[model samples]
Target chain A: MDILGDLLLGVQTAFSFWNLTYCLLGVFLGTAIGVLPGLGPTATVAMLLPVTFGLSPETAIIMLAGIFYGAQYGGSTTAILVNLPGESSSVVTAIDGYQMARQGQAGKALATAAIGSFIAGSIATVLIAFFAPLLSSVALAFGPHEYFALMVLGLAASVVLASGSLLHAVGMILFGLILGLIGTDVQTGAMRFTFGSFELADGISFVVVAMGVFGLGEILSNLENESDRTTVLTKVTGLMPTRADLRAMLAPVGRGTALGSVLGILPGGGAMLSSFASYALEKKVSKNPQQFGKGALAGVAGPEAANNAGAQTSFIPMLTLGIPSNPVMALMIGALIMQGIQPGPSVVQDQPVLFWGLIVSMWIGNLMLLVLNLPLIGIWVKMISIPYGYLFPCIVAFCLIGVFSLANSTFDIWLMGLFGVAGYILRKLDCEPAPLLLGFVLGPMLEEHLRRAMLVSRGDVTSFVTSPISAVLLLVAAALIASVLAPAIRSKREEAFQDED
Target chain B: MQGHRTKDFWAGAIYLVLGLATVILARDLTLGSAARMGPGYFPTVLGGLLAIIGLVSLLRGLLRPGELVERIHMKPMILVIGATLFFAIALDFLGLAVALPAAMFITATASKRFRLAPVPLLGLVAFTIFCVLVFVRGLDVPLPMFGTLFGG
Candidate 1:
């Protein structure tokens, strides 16, 4: 079917009473959490995953997708108002956004972010509708060798792009892969790492690990330093941007959307990278670069647009190729698998409603966020002031109940607690859990492909390089690693991520 | 000795131990050839790579200046994990009615500003009711409102 026909079908599905309600709820909850400092979409989604089990796949995904992009919109609200980024992707937005708020242009800044995000989201949604099918069709042609190579590229790129020590990131990936090995082997029916636990015979649930690490772990970290949050603007005055502001923001929004859409498609690149890159780009191309850190509308416009766009487009890989570009997408893929749907090239054909409805709902979710963020900005500003003391307990309650609901087993809860401690320690050690999550999700698939490819080639290791596509992919992975290892590029990479620290 | 204090040194040490453990544990599994890769093939290879990476990071930590591991705060970390474990142990015995509030109460103590204020007390009560209503009544998650010990 044509994109228009598909989108129309999606509209029909998304506009259903339940879907629409869940979409609204998803975005609403997303914005609420996004406006709250220290709570992120990853943990929120992980905590909420089990709740979606009772819903239809399309509805479930639409709601989850809403939370993802809706976060980008809500993140900018806190960034602008409180000077604290509610989400990591909004870190750059705070640089100029908070400045604008302090200058009594909080309304204008908020409005710019909303408008920019909506436009970028709309454009990216269209790009997904246009491109996802093409990519899926291409991926359908991949053999075991190609898949193995592709996963290697994905893992390699994720490690390289992730901020922190390269060795640590790689180690985390291997650790995750090892963790993924702890279950009965599919081919042989032999247990690999269950350690005689019957509960682990089926393998660790993704929700359990995610909730423990991102959810409980984050709460532990947040509690470590409970700093008081000070909201700068009590009241926002101008709700609309002036024509001059609009003109200044237009080019940046367009450029940011373009950059974000491209970057979001790359493995390990998503909202965070896109926003940072857009901020850097805006500073470079600006006629008055000095105004960047001091209330440049372009800085607010660019990163907000980029982040939303990146968040939207990052779904392309997960939707088409079954490869997650980031942790949120990894969770989504896990959700799909739990729904008894294998996420890959065939998903586009087999689950058009899910694929298309999710795409269409993103646009609707963006619209919801724009309206929700602009008029209801006061509520969010108030929400940030809500004490961590009250919030953490509730978060803990939710996580416990959520994990317990997985099978009504306390064992999972204990496992979650174990990982929570591990996660906290790992963070202290400067090892990112993001790559590890991705690796865990991809591990079984990677091993399967590797083994199949070897068998197909009769143990010929050269088959990987012999296949042109696989060869190119491996070369790309090699180049990425080499670039990160090179002293010149290593320093440059560190500088790019420097602002984050 | 100072190098032993670096975050990388500890992280690398942890990874090394985990990697070596994985390799050692997988020794009993059939290590089939490259043509017909066994269940052990992937883990053994990955385990070895991890060990190598861990060793390199460990050496790097010892040889070069690195960031020191931050002070570990035992209070929040332990309390939060303790609360979850408390909930797990209590759920089957006391049920959600008892377990949820107790867990929330324990978790509340993790924060320095925690106080026995009326607002937080009300919040605890309200949140427990909300969870019971939502998860138990609305979603029917199969968890007992009150557990076996309570004749739920």
Candidate 2:
């Protein structure tokens, strides 16, 4: 399908009043939460997931996607004004952004971030519109063998890139897979591990697990620390970037957008790593690297651009292949599942309006964020002071009500509580929850494909290796694991030599 | 601070038990041939893989030292999780209005900045009302204001 045709369909769905209103509401609320410390797009989305249950799938997703746009943009707001990043991707933005604030150029920095993000988002959205259909067609050609191999590669890649020890990350993935296999077998309709209860027959809802882990668990962890809740940013003197500032940012935005768009399509790469990579690239290629931590326009513009671009392109894999590249994408997949739409290549074929509309809304959401956040910076800044004392309790209340609304069984609330404790325990052990979520989302699918592929080959275990695409995918999965282990083995050898000496 | 090895050992032990449990549970299900696999075949393999992973992790925990485990905060762990459990159990008996506030109040009290001030008290009450109006009345979540336990 031509890019123009798809986007035209998207515009038709996106421009509807209800869809437009929800898109605006999503970005607006997303930005609102993103500006607040310790409450990010993930937590906000997880907590507010129940609100989408009543809406159509297309409308529900537009609002959620809007939140992401708002949050990404809002992350820069806190980074510039308060010297603290509201999200991890904005950590690099905070380095020079906070310096600009200190030097009384906060307005210039904020404007650069907003404009750079808008430019990058516009470019990446176009890229997605063009590429998604092509990718979906390719995905449609994949057999169960290739799909299974791809999932294995994806899971392994996530563990290698996770923010924790290899053992812990692996452990989390294994644990999540175990959790995913808790229900009845799809083939035989035989209850696999349901034990006795009817609730166990269908397995646990991803909603309960997500809200419990990200939302409730976060509340538990945040409540442990005593916060001062004082607003650090005193005042803003200016609100626009000069011509010179815009000129300096042009290259970084271009480079960062290119870098992020490519990286975001890779397995286990998304906004957080893209932003960091862009910042490092800017520093290395800068004419005056010494000016890096001292309020360089490229420093603010590059990462902000990269993060937004990465966030936009990360949707490609989830939209076409039904694979989540990160935790946020995992949540999006969960959202799609809840809307009763199976996530895969057929999403475009089955629900063209919903699929294209979401793509269009993402672009429109970015535009809305640019227009909404810039004029309303003063109001967003004040939101940073919203105390944790109030926030945590409110989150707790929502989690309870939200989980309760799912099937109207109070039992889900109890299940969420159980996972709340489990999530916190995993966090304490330094096990990243992102990979666990990915594993959970992929586990059942992985099993089905593995079995089907074997069944198709008539008991020939070597059939997976014989298929070219599946073989290549398996090799990639093996390579990822080998790369991770190579470093550890080398370190151990060096340690042994040092001990002998 | 005991190193994370202690925690790793515990984590591995849990993984080991879960893997073994899965293996045991699925033992009865037919593990059909590769061409026509039964329901137990995939999970049994996964269960075995998990068991091996747990064993390797356990060995690594013994060999390599790691970061210190974070100190657990009991107050919030008990109050927050407990409050959620309390709400779940109480919701059917006491209804949404009472059960919701009870959970929120417990969680709010667990906060370091929380005090018995009117602002916080009022805020909690107001949030509950908002949720009730939105979820119960607007969304029609079927949560009663009072429950069978209250004879309402």
Highest-scoring model, TM-score? 1
Stretches of candidate 1 exceeding 4 Å from the true structure: B1-4
Question: Which residue pairs collide in model 1, if any?
Answer: none
Model 2 DockQ, alpha carbons vs. true complex: 0.72
Q: List iRMS for all predictions.
A: 0.8, 1.5
Encode model 2's per-residue lDDT on A91-199: one tens digit a residue.
8898899898888888888899999999999999989888888889888999999999889888887876665567777877877887887888889888888877898
Q: Which sections of candidate 2 miss by over 4 Å? A: A488-501, B1-5
DockQ of each: 0.89, 0.72
How does each model score on lDDT? 0.91, 0.83
- Chain B TM-score in each of the candidates: 0.95, 0.89
Q: Which whole-number lDDT from 0 to 100 does residue A86 have in model 2? A: 75
Please give, for residues B1-152, the per-residue lDDT of candidate 2 as tens digits: 44445666766776788789889998988888788989888788878878887888777667777455678777888999999999988887899878888888888778876678887778778877888888889988888778778884
How much is the lDDT of residue A102 in candidate 1?
A: 87
Estimate the TM-score for candidate 1. Answer: 0.99
| Model 2 error, position A183 (Å) | 1.2
